[model samples]
Target: MKYPSTSTRSAIAALLCCTSLVPGQTAAQDAVQLPDIILDSGAVADDQTIVAEAISAGGKLTGDILDIPASVSVVTSAEIERRNAKDIEEVLNYTAGVVTNSYGADDRFDYFSIRGFNAYTYRDGLTLGENFGGIREEPFAFERVEVFKGANSAVFGVSDPGGSVNYVTKTPRGARFGSAYGTIGSFDTKEVGLDFGDVLNADGSLSYRFTGLVRDGEREYPFSRNDEVFVMGGLSWQPTERTELTFVLDHLDRDDVPGSGGFPIGYDFDRSDTFFGEPDFNFRGTERTTATLIGRHDFGNGLSFGGTARFSDGNDDFGYAYVSGQTATDANRSFFASDSAEKVAIADVHLAYDPQFGSFASSTLLGFEASRSESSNKRYFGPAPSVSIDDPVYTGAPSSVPLFADGETEVSGRAVYLQETLDWNDRVIASFGVRQDWIDITERDLLAGSSATNDISATTGRFGLTYKATTDLSLFASYAQSVVPAGTGVEPENGEQFEIGAKWRPLGGGTLLSAAAYDLSKTNITRTNPVTNLPEPIGEIRVRGIDLEAKAELGAFDLTASYSYIDPEITENGTAGNEGNQPARVPNHIGSIWANYTLEGDGARGDMTFGLGARYSGSYFFDDANVAGESDSYVAIDAAYTYALSDNTELAINATNLFDEKHVAFGGFYADFYSPGREVQATIRRSW
Candidate 1:
């Protein structure tokens, strides 16, 4: 019973030698049968956190997660080591319409929002760069974190109609493994990590894996600090058995003093650790490089083919000393500097088909994608030195901020797609999709020499339906469409969404419930001219939502919860007091909950675990006219503990914002963003 090696048995002996090349259909009708295209079903094995079922993210879908009718979330890696997650927006903080950090206590990147627009971050299914230029991701080199929410460009083509986040990497798993981790907390935090895998031969078809991380952290402002380094490597090749290939390389280095300016108008939250700049004049530096390639092949009655290619490069340098306005005690400063470089390239190809006509079952996919990106900037915006929010500050430095406004940008995209899914007997399911896109953009104002170019094209679509009356309930409906690319010359903003959902998995199936109601919209949208902030193409937006989710595992208890309610409007506005308002910050109730419990007993108290969490946000608005500058509602708490020092060591402790809630997680048209206070950590891990 020697299994694994992706057991395709040389693709079933080349489908029985292709039945003599299909002549006269003699070898039992050319004996060919194959299915199981290997899509996700990895990761969850470190004492499982109960994932029940998954797959179906950008791995181009192949069921489970209630047969995907949109709105997806998977955070595994045992929920990022039980929420000690350090980035990727803290692994989507309880996800459901999502909004994480949104520009508050930054960590060089990852500012989020979904369902109310703006989202980007993908990595195994490509494009892990560019989201306003600083893309940083390294949640211990991911092994899960997928969020799909609205409009995925019908299979990730042009992106951002409120959703898309991938990150799945952590490859090469053929056998022998090792792991190590260490962490220590509270501001002077320190961390170390490593993971390794092996199987360089012995006919096991070659394998390799490595992941690394080193972090030295400190933040709560006041001379901020955070230095990070990460490295990842992978290689896997199968030779034949319908072939498989994987290669990946990664690198990231960052030096930080980020979270630059925010907090001025009346500066509340008890001053939230005020720091009017000049901890030697602020800083942010980064270097990133990545490469990826993945391939798969299989051919039998149910064909299959796969591909992925990615390349990324980033280099950024930042400087800041800002707080532009404030009085009662003086505060008015500005100094910005930047140096940038970003490059990205992506490619994808696909072909998949699974068929059976007897009881009618089907799965089909076709794809093509290409992308190119470039960004270059050198900026400096002057005027500094003015402090005292309550008692003065240092003088300027970093050579006193000088060069201003230089730019360059380039973007290219191409796409093609087709998808289909159908099943009639297992209780009727249906799916359909179509996509087309073309985009080109170039811009340069390198100190006002001026240059611009634009091209656009679009088509997007999606349709879904699912129904399964019993055996754990299910009902769904969906409609989606999206198109972006707007600005250089205009035309290309359209978006659409419509959804209805219900899913249940009661007692026997153990707990998992979901609900959704949505109406999303976007159009034209480009308005800003409070007297020459320029850019106006009128604007329109609409968002109406309701989403709720629950996940559970009962015997030893584990739970997760989510809720969201949106309702954002700005339906057409070109100023005039910001027609309809309510855009900045977009929040109308967002909730989260988490729970965990475990006691186990290897005969005499060996394992233990406990966790609790909570988060809520509501208030909104901070600009775009809607006056009085809102942003008040808040709540936060988190806790965790784990111990299991036996079979292969483990110890954990985690906390976030626990009790140190400073209100306003974000609300900045120009200042007001907090949360970077409580964080306590402790960890030790070992495995073999």
Candidate 2:
């Protein structure tokens, strides 16, 4: 299969993210971090709500959530352990305005949508999922996950207007901690992990940390498997009281059979019992390494400077098969193979001033960022043997496939931004921000011996207002814009959003409740006409939605809940009769709630906790034409039970899809469109 030409721009954004590790290693926000805005005095909130007290992705760097007029969701390490998420999607399961597992049981990459549009994945504020290398990460390598809703090019120059997801890497700290764990579960799965860190010198001037994990498991599908090994370490040095520097490195190796959603031949056959493809010939292998350096210097008198840089190298090989045509029980299969290599480097630096004007304080920042990325890809597609849905025969193997596409893509981006936040009596805040960005991309079709170069530039900004009606309630409104560079000769896509919201902390700062409504639209979207089978660039679409979220600790109970409703419409489309139709595969109603209560000392089990969760997605159209009808709506239930064997030892059991609910996530897509079956696991951990 040939690679999508338009996907080339991801290389720039991906490389751009690699350069922002400075804001990430020291990023004190809930999840997403901003470059050049590193603050020396912020860390993850130590409360049970799993929400960060300060989050930069919301458009600023401050400890008070109510201070920023945007929507941000953070999931801390404490909650990560509670949820035991297996992948990135699971980490944001309870966050508002987001949906995951839309392709069912695919393990090759993490896919999800935020506010009716697909979101990009980041680590330490750098792009990972959107990279051309098809990067995949193990959740054990990160400390927390964060989500920033809506476009804010003023904060992040190039981003999806719908939203952003960021994972904070585990880094060295001044605190002492250690843990080791082992897990065994359904499908013959086995896993082990270790985490340890602490201050390495007197006065806590130096610190070190290391985290690693290994896992072996089988996918829900018959004869398929998933496995990975990952390790990461870091060192931090505070040479002076106001100066700090840190270095981090990580490596990952993985081999697995990618997941698949059988053709839309109806779900009459049992998914677990049917063999749709050649499992023996299917495989995906990956190896990657990355290093980052971050530093910040604080000058007295409300001035500071921060810098971060990162570089990464990755390689991947994949081979898979799918049904091309079929009779009642027999099917003709096709084979696809690809090998890719990618390199990315990015850096950022910024200066911030926080001048205290007595009762009227203001914080201002200016920064510059740049990134470059290059990727070489080779693709192969051909014919494979036939298979049966009932008693199958794997006689023929397509070990050789004809090369289809061979190409290389290079991308680079640079941007400068300025932001100012003014506070009046600590009760009102007005924010003004602007960003100017320039991007260049070059694509070389090696097979055809041809190359093309394209460049684009745009300016984006955000204006926001906040009013503190009381100590516990705040009302706010904001306008933000984002720009994404399309491939080849296509003009860049533009995203605009207008949002209004309220934040309330009725039960003190430890508890937060927020509601936001936004009108979001994107123009210059590239689409293909269904009838003519041709691409169109003048397409436009809109998604309007409301998000309600809560995170709080009531006595011994800590819980998070959210409900989101979105209205998606295709205002202008290349496909005939698609105008006014709902976007395919986007759900209108999405809601989820997760809570766990700790019980007092139990008879034999030290301390016990029981957790339960429910996730719901409303009906959605299956195609852009809205003629294939809507898909089945599904509600998935999850449950967990944990027992503390001792102060340092604990055992837990977790299960997802408790009832084995089966349904289609995206209809008629060759990808894994069916939801994953039931999964259960038991883990024992030792920590101090």
Candidate 3:
């Protein structure tokens, strides 16, 4: 028999008997004495960011949104709760400078464009790796989403200059709380979810949280289903008041998935509810698991260290077909069935230094990051099936189809970076950072029995300054560089951006107004690589744009509005008939407005709230080539109502696309896609 060592046992005993708050208790802990700009992790108070006034994506360090020199947008947990978001894309549908749900009601993945390009999706500061087509994430598991705009390779290592999305997850809180809810909604949706947290030991050193969800839902297309199970557990141990460590594990199992539908151009939008695939043949499933660990230590000196690491593995299988070719009423279905797997490991560590010298103060950060990713997929093609487009006929699935060898990819990356921020008398702030990245990728083509390796290195940096004109206003300017590696032998894609912006709180606290204008250009434009699933340089593109936003919380009313204008041009490309044309699906104009009002009674039990919103997306080309005609612009409306049944219970109803407008969301991939007409959901929740 083996037991813990004497040193380990003594340490455990000391932690168990230390002066502390109870497990899951968020009280009586000593906070690191760093300035808000450094945003020491231990300084984050429980429930302080429900409205998300502070963000961590802009600079890899949590800080006030107003302090960051870039364009940033945050979708808070409170906001997500009120909206009852169905997917990640829907959660950011109304945010400025971005477009979501690009393919309408596609339930397989969340598609979105930020600042005219696809941005990286990260959770807790780590990428989930290129998808193997099987994994799905639940929106309810997140606490907030931060959108950091412009080139940020200096801080993040590798990325598209457009921006990045960082999802802050829900972890163990310092206090005890729990909630459970049941929901019923359009498309035969039924779901139940629970979240609970509490202290784990007599001393407040150990805390734990558990969140779970089970859902059965259907897609816009008839006969397509989406069934899921999600479970997450988190533990936080504060062995000492000034130091802490947290661990989290997340698992998602999708027993069934909604099929992806494809139709001909100019197809009738009214037929969105129609299913064109054989029910038994169109099937998909995904099983995934991920683990994350975060640790922070305040040396009690002016130095602190923060480290995070994550690992993920997933498996996916799909058996579905889409319209390959069609003429008038006859359609040719391309049958495809595939199996895929993905694994990823990523970690980041940083040391921060803060010092105050009279009127001048400074914060410096030195960091290292590394990651490894692998993916493989094998696919089979069966005999094509034919069905009438006007009136599709259902038939049984065909038998044995010959399989073909596919490809696999392995990617590894390592980076080192440093940043410094100087605060001059609290009036002028200057920020600067630089990073160097080394990447290696290997791809294997099974059928050809061939493999290739590519090694690349790049240096990126950013510089910015902010000047506080008054207590209520600030002005900023920034310049940044980014790079993305591509296929073997192809030079990596590179981009640069210059931006100027202003933030104002004219009405004082709780009110904010901001505006920004930027010029962004990229050489060696990139496309998704088949084997590695990473962007590979292809052409060149440029974009100039402006973003405007306003948000206010005045007494019983809360409101938010946004508008953006962009002009995109494909400056250089092969003779593919796309040069000098606007990039496909890049809208020129987008706007939205939303507001809510609360009516209160003498007691908290009788409170009532009403909310409404509207969004507009301008027309754009369906393909990079100008040959494809332009699409039609569309407007959407959403609404919600909530009633507090009691202190710990509530009833809520929400609707999206309230008017049931049948319109084309976007078009590409040789097929037309339409937005879902409308959806309504009702939920009853209890909390204590």
Candidate 4:
């Protein structure tokens, strides 16, 4: 039987051939042996195994998502379709060891924390951060979402502890055409999307795809609205089996209607207090444009290379308004406004090689990346004119506020890294890699008459070992390190991590379980005063945690569950001891479970699948001092169903936050905001 082309097949075959003919080899070793047909053994049919192989191949060939040698999670297109996810946050929430928070009134400014780390958003493995909010791109154009947990300085040079999120763009495939979809839900929400793919040339070597979305919605909260439109086009050229090139152009325009500023911590739940502030505070109204070009080449002899270049420009105008007072009598209100614009450019190249030696095989990758970003933000502060309880008016003309004159910041970085994986006798594997980065930052405080520029560099490394105890069970342990330079106007810090884990599959291809324990520390962190030029030590932070996950499929039922416990603290500080007293907002307990069942199998016109899921988070503090009160723990449940109408048509219904649990995922020192309320949406789609 013929099997799919795999790097290990050739390497192993060559090794066995050489070993059998050795002069000292016995008759048993000299005998000819047949190559193992991995595909026929039902091993290559599993999604997990296929994904793992893809990752290995990618690491050895181009060092994309496959070379990181870290804990990685991939949400496939089928999973996204099954869940009917609408945004990046929705998809990431289902991933293990990830936490997401949305605080703005409209919940458009989504913030993600992964394994107690932060990630700089990327599209197609390229940086997509902006000046105002770092990142706010929609996920409608992505084919899948890949999350790399732990420190990823090797891939993204200067980043946060939250790891990184890369959205793989959807490109033209072999298909010809597709239909549009529309969804409607609570808060007068409406969303429409269209996708089309086709071969433009008779030879099937040239193809194009166009995808676009327009959405207008309102949150369950009072006085919040969102409007956004996105369009992207992709062109692909596959002139030969050995090479491929693709280009994409994307654009986004978003507007937030006027609304109440942030919600009050204590009285926000009372629907009657909706009129606490002016109803004209707009958070973000912006336009972003991006273009990317990617190319890949394969040299047949277990060697491949790829490169990508991207550019983005953005502009945004936002306002902040709030009321301060005890009761209905003496409350005073104020308004603050800011306008920002930014430009960014990035380029990256990757190369991979696979070679065989006596009784050993190795896959190696080398990569380099560089990025430049510039941004300017101007602030305006003024008093809000008082009017009737129902009516509020603008009082002062907008002008640059004193002591804060149009702050301008610029940041740039270059990085290079190498990764290698070694396999011995197809049972034991060892991986090693390292990354080096150079970062530069410039900040100008116009009002303070001061300017600062700082340059810093660092190197990080990773090592791991995996032993195949059995065909179905594998034990693995890994340690990785990461470093992040301080943002503009701040100095850099040093961070290190230690981890060990084991993976077990008791039922071979049927059930998979994994457990891990990790400890991470960071020192010499830089903290700067917003008004002063002095920099202070933020102290040392230590985080230790354990993660447990299980996935299984029995008959027609599928199950996935995960649990995590974290103890993060500040070990040393100028103000306090023991690692800053349990780093604020880092919850100690997090868990999630999801299950699905399918009905109708024997020659039915359609099939139906139903899914149920739940997420739980423990109490967390809100401030660094740990003096602020703790946010209450909460549990949320969701359900979804899909029915196939025909070979090319289907319908799906998704309900999120079924219990409408009132909880706060995150909050600032001064105020807190509630997460989205219950929402339900239905969609119909067709493909040809």
The lDDT values for all models are 0.74, 0.77, 0.77, 0.66
TM agreement with the true structure for every prediction? 0.32, 0.91, 0.90, 0.85
> Considering summed lDDT, which 10 consecutive residues are worst modelled in model 1?
1-10
The all-Cα superposition gives candidate 3 an RMSD in Å to the true structure of: 7.9
**Candidate 4: tens digits of C-alpha lDDT, residues 251-361:** 887766434544445554533245445454546677889888989899978898888888888888877555533334333556777788999898888887888887788
Candidate 4 C-alpha error for residue 12, in Å: 55
Candidate 2 stretches with Cα past 4 Å from truth are 1-49, 57-62, 129-133, 261-264, 528-535, 602-605, 669-672
Question: For candidate 1, lDDT tens digit of each residue in 1-688?
Answer: 1121232334334333432333332433432322212334542342255354565454576566676777777777777788787887777888888877655685667777887777766777765633544566777887777787787677776666677788778888766665566787876766667766667889878888877766666676667767676778899989877888999898887777667466676557343356777777688878888888888888878988898888888888888777777777777878887888888888888899988889888989998888898888888888887887777668858565667778888988888888999988767789988988888898888887988888888889889888878757778888888776765766777777888888787753547788888888887776556787545668777888988988787888889889999888877875455767777777878899888998887768678889988888787776656774777778788889888877566899999978887766655545566766788899987655
- TM match of model 3 to true structure: 0.90
Q: List the residue pairs that clash in candidate 4.
A: 117-161, 117-162, 118-161, 118-162, 569-579, 570-578, 570-579, 570-580, 571-579
lDDT of 4 at 241: 78
TM-score of 4: 0.85
Check candidate 3 and list the clashing pairs. 21-204, 22-204, 23-199, 24-174, 25-174, 26-174, 525-538, 525-539
Residue 148 in candidate 4, Cα distance off native in Å: 1.4
Better of 2 and 4 by lDDT: 2
Tell me the TM-score of model 1. Answer: 0.32
